[model samples]
Target chain A: MKNFSRFTLLSLLFLYLFFGNCIVGNFSSVYAQDDWKQEYSSVCAKTQNAMILTPEELKSYIDRCDKLLALINELEGEQAATEKKVYTKRVKMCRELYQFALEYKEHK
Target chain B: MAPIQKLLSAFIIALTVPVSASAADYSHYLRHIPPAENFGQVVLDNYSHKAGVLPVTFDHWLHRAKFTCRLCHIDIGFAMKAEMTEISAADNMSGYYCGACHDGKRVFDGRNIFGSCAENYTEDEGKRCARCHSSAEAEERKYDYKSFSEKLPKLPGNLIDWEKAESEGKVKLTDFLEGVSYKREPLKAQDDFTIKIRSWDVIFSHRKHTVWNGCELCHPMIFPSTKRGTTKYSMFQIMMKGEYCGVCHTSVAFSVWLCAKCHITLVE
Candidate 1:
């Protein structure tokens, strides 16, 4: 009887380890990851509020950003020929504007 | 004495349980890739009550026939996993969710789509609701799996090969939904470039993605707007079934084994 008890305890321990590990892995796969809204501040909520735009407006924002990026890439090739400091400042401004459009799309 | 018998019984029960469960075919019906029927129906039935009614069904086969899965799941706004999206009737009624497609004028049966939301409810309206929530019904088994799938256009490769069909001009997705879209000129396609993978020498083609996904798919969601490199992802996670690129790779699209398509230069 005593031997049987010992065997029982050993079996339970093995079961616990095996089942416990499976459960942990399964749960992690199902819900372990997080999304942007959950991780980021409610600033996203604020951005979505008040203003409403059609899909066209949203696409236009994406287009504007792409054009800006293209222009920046083009200017980088000509940095030596152009006025150094002024061109650099203009590039920075364009990049910043591009980011604004990007953020607007996200917030939308 | 009595307690000892109880412990012994418990041990025997536990030992048998795993063996029995393992013998049962939990995934028997899901062997070969099931065609993209309204999989969301079964998915919602299995999980929705615990989650919410927003477990609205999204049929991939029907939509992919006309539009690419990338248009909705990738572009419009949808989570790859069923019941994961935080959908609401208000969102749909306000031109979100199912309303994105069900809008009355754009396509068929769009007006009656407002059934998901109404100030008052009745017994008859529940019938229309079953159009989506049909998994629990007795008639569900009536949908002959073989017959229904055979009727639908075979996906050529995976039942969800959106890019292949779209590039062939088989699918024409309406990027601009009337009443939903304001108005904007079409954006020019950017020259395709390789997104060099870290560690792995995989090359992701922007052109390939655009063929199916168009620009809207990747722009604000997967990569996010403006915050470059913010979304950290791993091939392992995707393989293990964390949606993203895996939603297709594991189930439908191309198997991950075709790594050379994405993964480039192998270190000699």
Candidate 2:
């Protein structure tokens, strides 16, 4: 009984330290960082640079890229598809870049 | 009461007290955040923490005197946060970001606005770096917010109106880049629409937003690619925190008390 009481006292003390007034809120908890979105934008910029199309020309090129991406996604889902994971990731990147391009236009 | 029961009650009381005290502490922190030196300074801190340094300061107060917020934030493609959009000095020099307005021949700064970049690089042009990197301590603020904003045509009707002066053409913002944004076709703006709120019935207007932020200010980052609801946010979180709307709402744009701006309905 004495040991049980002692263990209970230790556990209560531990709980007080862990979740009590020890940790104060800092900037990180106050803000949410969107790492996923930042990575997406970076990937998009790299994929589109190879073509080097003018602003007007870039739109049509991006549209075609979007169609190609949808086709690739459809192919990947089929029963006998053999596309590599890298290829699938690249297609996803292209579609995201195309959307970013459209967003650029809307902003303009 | 037995010893065990007495201890249990003490623990429960201890837990409740801290939670209540912590909430009060956060509320106090929100009330005490310092005002920034300038709007650009505030924007830079918010932007840099989120992304990185912008190619330039991109002053709203200076630019809005001649142009409207719609001209650049909408038409020119400047994001609200720096580095979110890939802005290069090369792009600006070619009339992309600051180049559209700073072009030496047509648009000049004060009276001598020049092209985005130099035709030739000068060997000793270190002094000119402060033009965009005005965040350095040496730079002096040209306009005082209180005096400058006092005479603004569109003075804010609410607690703090960050965009009121800029919206009324009291500030001139440049949109065309001498080289990058070569195409200068006039834009016929679409009529303002009421973006339906999902969880609440608050209707956000495109017209009011255009006064402070053009389309590019939000776009795919805050809103997203497809027409989907923005991530859920709470008033308590935004007022005392940072995020999409909180970026401005808590800082310069408006005070936290103006709940009607977003949350239209009040629950009794």
Separate DockQ for every predicted complex: 0.02, 0.02
lDDT of 2 by residue, A3-36 (tens): 9999999999998877664453333322212232
lDDT of 2 by residue, B122-239 (tens): 7555445446645523453345445555666531232224465545554555554433232322232334544354443556665666444433345444554433343444433444
lDDT of 1 by residue, B96-157 (tens): 54656654434443333233443345877655555555453335233433454453333423
Q: What lDDT score is found at residue A50 in candidate 1?
A: 10
lDDT, residue B101, candidate 2: 66
User: What DockQ class does candidate 2 belong to?
Assistant: incorrect
TM-score per model over all chains: 0.47, 0.46
Q: What's the CA RMSD of model 2 in angstroms? A: 25.0
lDDT of each: 0.45, 0.45
